[model samples]
Target chain A: MTEKSAQRRPGGRTARNRENVLRATAEVLLHEGYEHLTVARVAAAAQVAETTVYRRWPSKAHLAADALSELARTDNPIPDTGTLEGDLRALLGQILALIERPEVRRVILTVVSLATDDDEVVAAKVAFWESRFVGAAAIVIRAVERGELAPESDPYELIEDLVAPTYFRLLVTGRPLDDRLVDRSVELALSRQGICAAPVPGRPASPSADD
Target chain B: MTEKSAQRRPGGRTARNRENVLRATAEVLLHEGYEHLTVARVAAAAQVAETTVYRRWPSKAHLAADALSELARTDNPIPDTGTLEGDLRALLGQILALIERPEVRRVILTVVSLATDDDEVVAAKVAFWESRFVGAAAIVIRAVERGELAPESDPYELIEDLVAPTYFRLLVTGRPLDDRLVDRSVELALSRQGICAAPVPGRPASPSADD
Candidate 1:
């Protein structure tokens, strides 16, 4: 049976070909924003037929999204440091490093802005986040269980507060994201009892006590 | 000469004309996103000649920034309710109202995104913030005086934390900038210090200590 048709192919040639195409797509995204990214260019760079490229991904935007999604997943490793502040520092630090790569930040900003107007791009972004959110949430939930965060707080918003400032300044204000800022953000959020410090609802202890 | 030449002739008419043009520009911005805005459109809406608009503001981006600067100046009111919590509530509440106005929010995002590429736009944004930051700082300083915040803390970053999340979510996530979210933001910031009743640094007292 052809590798492409097989439901469970023991992959060698087909999978390597796919990886090469994705790597080429990522290179294009790094060099050009989403608008200029072309499937033909990717096909040429990947040494594959345009038909083969089209058979796997119908659009350049989808190809670019997939490439970036793959990069984001692998490059930024989420650390489970057993504390909310430590975890945020680790995760946001990775994000900062990712942004530090020139043109990557611009590409991500362009992708996000385009996503605002395109449903397919938005779905791609959501899918990317969906792949990571569960892992990120595990870190937060562990922090809560360990009394590093206030038990009553919503982990999502708490994470948002810690990292959103950096993203806002980086993407909107054209500012560089840095580690000092990340540490400050973690301190600021954790000090508020909203991360791992919020007391569990209906299980509040003495005023100075933890849940 | 005419009023135009009179303003150009080093007199008060320049300020009045600028104000009138700025007001008209703000009206347009409040109605349309920055992408859809134009200098000619602003001039028509302001009842000013196209040359007159060009004579002062060089481009649509400049006109939009100037309009926002004027708006920021006019609404520089942050209520001093003698508590950090109340102060933040009022301060954030004002921002919430502004973001809820779709036209203003759209213009803000457009201009902010443009700032990434345009030096002139970035300068205009910086200048606008220079004026507004003073007002925002005044509120934070007052909170320090009233024993509502950490006396030695950096007011700028604190304000950044308080405001960045909502703007981030609004512009990036396209979420509804609702009051509940605003309230939670204020609460999170305040819970860190005695925005409600923490005494000054040298003095010792936690008003909520009884709880």
Candidate 2:
């Protein structure tokens, strides 16, 4: 590729080429995972040079970050259901769907790993969450303002409680983010019935110290 | 430098030496962080051989993991005040204290990152949480038995809500784990007063959509 090609698209062809490169990167990441992600493979799959790929992104982490950012751009917004539970269910359901997607899940893990060590990547991840998480926060905030949530509640903390476990499951257990799990989580978070009450007979039971 | 020497401590050397090794490793981590952690440097600082370190831990991460595991074990257990809120407050307070340690926070983030991609490392992480979260869950179970909690609650979910967000803040936002945050979280997870109720004035407005 030419020097100019590295910075700006020669034409619409360049834009299309960048998209193809990103698409192929996501595909490889989904199929082979971050461990196998390589600039050479992306270039080959996108029919571009290794240099071309590197020119656009400094590292595989950077590439994956870009792809996730692109994915979030069109992410479905949580519906404006008037009830907190309904809205939470919808929102959690949507997040669950995204978490369940094979490639998307891999990308998410990859991005989180990148966020852990790299300041630049962390900045990017924070920016993405600032937009996306903030958007989610707005929905909850609206619910709180409308007397649907407790008066003393903080929406940020509420979001942390509601959504953090799902991400924790993703990172720690690799648990299936199915509809059932999402439903239960949403129910527990929004109702206070699940978290506040005592033990259920048939549930997993309290984790013992022996755990 | 012999294999036997590497595997065993030299006859009755200062116990202070071992402490120095751990302290030096922590200092290096605070200065350079986990990504730059090296067995060679740690060994040099401790006045131990590379072979000695190798015999003890196969990798830098393993060394760090052991250090962290030991740190967590040394921390005080969650206090029992016969109230769910008090117990959680005590547990979360200990956790926050761990994160506030000079280099401990970075070590945890490093572990969480490794856990994302490495299942063995995650298993170690799981073992770590089992000590904290699972142990806390036991308190809730006992509370249920004592009729302190509502009869119908799920202990696992309750524990999940209580502890999950603290881990989330550490891993996600890199936020300092503070008592105020823990207090609010415990209050929300334990009580129905603020979280699930319809929003009232000065609070976020109520969710309009009823299920």
Candidate 3:
């Protein structure tokens, strides 16, 4: 397991080349937007030969998906603050921050357009989102276990409700994504699911928690 | 305002020219997408001089906004089924069908990207959404008048709550927008806003109406 031995290991060069190319792809996409993106620029940025770029990725769309898959692999950090309300806001705020990035916004539009035409891209994106939902579901599961949320609560739907308005405003309605919108989104998602009946955090509770 | 006089009116030719150009813009976008879309092609399809297209719209983005403005103006026909639930489904169904169109989806993605970069596009898009919201708000206002929703209900938020998830799934997550999702969205919007307590259609109620 020495450095030289590791470098000579099978698939090591391939993995390293992938890392460099994908990193370059993201940098070009972020700074230049999608239209300015080209295989030549990416190859130059990565310091890899154009053939190496083509050998790994058949198309720019595939290259973009590789970068997005990397993004989707980033763990959805679940904030632990002892209440479902705080947890949702922290998780949602994290999402707000991610989507608010100008580069990510540009990247997402490209991904969405690709998803529309290509089945493989659609499947990959759906799987990516499903995985993210599983991560976010941790907060809801903890609440349900703590007797804050109903046992029947569907976490995917809950997360979708909390997150959808922001995406809608971002892509469709062109509304501002601000703190007020976030607060209302959290409120609506919780209250609609009947989790709003939970007693206030410092209040004394009766024997019947349902009330 | 007879038909012949209307056609002979001062703005009539201008109106006809606009229709031709906008239709041409949409055809090119649907057939070729945003990349091949150029003023020359649009002018050729529109049967107008290229200078005419330039005089009317400064850029391809401007031409796109004008076409999108037309789509947004098609009134969101508020369905008048008796129940608020029925009305929501109808509105949501209409939205689902529109977004499902390949052409509309392409147009929307282009418009969203343009809005991000151009001030004029942003203003035009924001105004268009505002108008659509105002039209959809009619359903909420009717429900309030029928004593189903609270009088203080903000229609825009309510509509946004139901519609955002659909757009999010379509453009961001690439999830299916089906009947189940529509039902859940409607239920969540109503329950969260405390509008789920209304009496049944045939139920007799006290004059006080607080029961």
Separately for all candidates shown, the number of backbone clashes (residues 3 or more apart, or on different chains) is: 8, 20, 0
TM-score per candidate? 0.77, 0.61, 0.74
lDDT of 1 at B76: 41
Which scores greater on lDDT, model 1 or model 3?
Answer: 3
DockQ ranking from best candidate downward? 3, 1, 2
Candidate 2 positional error at A25, Å: 5.0
Model 1 alpha-carbon miss at residue A54, Å: 7.2
| Candidate 2 error regions (>4 Å) | A1-63, A75-77, A80-83, A115-117, A137-155, A173-180, A191-211, B1-70, B114-125, B141-147, B151-155, B173-176, B192-211
Cα lDDT of model 2 by residue, B1-211, tens digit: 6966754454455345556666766667666787777989999989988887776566676666555555666674657888777777877787777777756666655555564556556555655556555656677777766656644455555666666677776666555467677876687566532344333223224322331
The C-alpha lDDT values of all candidates are: 0.68, 0.64, 0.73
| DockQ class, candidate 1 | acceptable
**RMSD in angstroms between candidate 2 and the native structure over all alpha carbons:** 9.8
Give the best candidate by DockQ.
3
On a 0 to 1 DockQ scale, where is model 1?
A: 0.25
- DockQ (C-alpha based) per candidate is 0.25, 0.18, 0.31
Better of 1 and 2 by TM-score: 1
Q: Residue by residue across A36-104, what tens digits does model 1's lDDT show?
A: 778888888889999988887767666876787778778987788767777888888888888888788
lDDT of 2 by residue, A116-171 (tens): 55676666566656666677777767776887776666566556666877876776
Candidate 3 residue lDDT tens string, B1-211: 6977864352867777889998888778776777788999888988899998888687786786667666655624778898888998888888888877877777766666553677766766776677677877888889988988755567788888888888887778877788898888888777866633322233332224562
